[model samples]
Target: MINPHKQQIIKPKKAVIKWLLDSDPAIRWQVMRDLTKEPDEFIVAERKRVATEGWVAQLLALQDADGKWGGVIFPAKWASTFYALLLLRDMGLEPTSEQARKAVSLVRHKVTWGQEHGNSPFFEGEVEPCINGRVLALGAYFGGASDQLVDRLLSEQLEDGGWNCEAPPSRRSSFNTTICVLDGLLAYENAKGACTAVTDARLRGQEYLLVRGMFRRLSTGEVIDRSWLRFSFPPTWHYDVLRGLDYLRSARVEPDEQVIEAVDLVAKKQHQNGRWPLQNPHLDQVNFAMEGPAATASRWNTLRALRVLDWYYR
Candidate 1:
């Protein structure tokens, strides 16, 4: 029988579809490919823009002579360098572009994060889970990923079925870090179904998010963090409930009762006008405006929330 809980998921509205299509070409590409039905030509045209004038160009402009986005191996901010590249790949940036080629060359030259390299850059040679996750994603994009990197990511999976950035030092599993890893793994899984290690690691990581109701505490039943409620644009590395839920739904995970709590949380935020607001922004040198931070309705956040809600409720 069709689950009664599933009845709540709704058919996506035209406004929501248009909004998703109109937003980031990278996200649009994900939605376009995942839609139960194929989107019209208009959506395809927008995805093509990634190649024409969007992030592919933006990231290219940010590149330095060394071929990395930020001059350092891993910028002080862990998410920006590799995670940002994954965002561009998600948008459908062609790997063959000159900028992409340069970026790939730079990544290959610096670190032994993947198997193509001769030795581990560090004495331990074991990379942090998040780093391996992003490197796996980069390799997936350029068809250069090796079994070694996938093995590293799989080995790092924590007891909770998620990943933790503070592996040897902190040791506490984290929500944000787990999502970032999942994002990269899912991208790799979709691109090439060849690697079982990445596939298993991703499945467990996804279970962790779902067990927490995507945004709430498993035992306490409280919202995990205030920041989880805030929606952000270009979600650098921070994991809001909105991004987590969207990722789950996009990956076609079955929604259980645990997801209902998250669904309720997101639903309450939608305004009477059927929109969500941008609660945060990436602290970057350049960004596009979405009204202001909190006052106006954010077209991007609304599109993401509504689509996720629609899929789950149906």
Candidate 2:
């Protein structure tokens, strides 16, 4: 059982949750599962709404007949087929749904990485591990073929146990790239129990982040970037402390002393009403705004932070 006092410290206030429940289905579905512990029937009903209503529905409706969004695989930053699938995955679309399957099929059969790669985008993947990581995740989550891509990504891991898009010239791994790869590997593993190589690579990648304390420089123990301290939604490919901690929780890793500082930073950001504010939104064009403009109290960030704390304190 979890410690009662610790639970109280991390639990969201009723008003905060009430506010969350009243929000879009994308946010509400996660809140129900992660925070509210709502019954399966209720959670399923709310999740089904994601396919038919609100932001998730709006995004899905934008899919072109060719099954690509914006008529391109990697179109504008946020409107491309890759990003569209990523957003859908984030929105908790039922992967097995007919519409979801069709979209995945289109990417597999119709989409290519262009003349550069001259192959199926999801299967072959692109040059950057950051992009490949996300592709691996989307492919695995949405039932596309990712075996070759997964092997390619794992083979590209740096000696430091992480990945960087700028690999050959700079062997050092990047926080942003590492988090993306971690999300991919984890998603693949959860969907299909694969080989030990995948697990080993994933753990090493995790250690890469852990060594830096999520968002710090190992050499000086200094914060890497000020923006990393700011929490955001639909993190895309960025790395922030909250994103790191939330990934750790999803991977079922226990809290460690190395993460204490980042954990403390998260706790301090909570509003008095037991909510968190959206500090930054990615500059990329999105299908639609999931939360309000920045500096407003954010249900996405609040739910993520609360869950991270819940896992840490438990």
TM-score of each candidate?
A: 0.77, 0.94
State the lDDT of candidate 1 residue by residue for 1-314, as single tens digits: 23323332355556656765676566666567654346667566655666657555666566666555554444534234554566666556768766567666766676443353355542122456666666666676776765676667677777778878887666557888888778768767877774667777788888888777777777897877888877886676689888889888768887778777677777777765556777867745442333466646776676677678767765
Per-residue alpha-carbon lDDT of model 2 for 1-314, expressed as tens digits?
Answer: 32323545566778888998898898899889988889999999988888888887798889887777887777587888888888899889998877677767776777788887766465568888999998888877877647888888888999999999998898999999999999999998988986699999999999999988888898998888999999988888889999999999999997878788788888889877778899978858677777788989988898898888878887
Best by TM-score: 2
Supply the global lDDT for candidate 2.
0.85
Question: How accurate locally, in lDDT, is each candidate?
Answer: 0.66, 0.85
* Model 2: pairs clashing at backbone N, Cα or C within 3 Å: none
Model 1: CA > 4 A from native: 1-43, 76-80, 96-103, 109-126, 169-172, 194-197, 284-291
Supply every candidate's count of residue pairs whose N, Cα or C atoms clash at under 3 angstroms: 5, 0
What TM-score would you give candidate 2 relative to the actual structure? 0.94
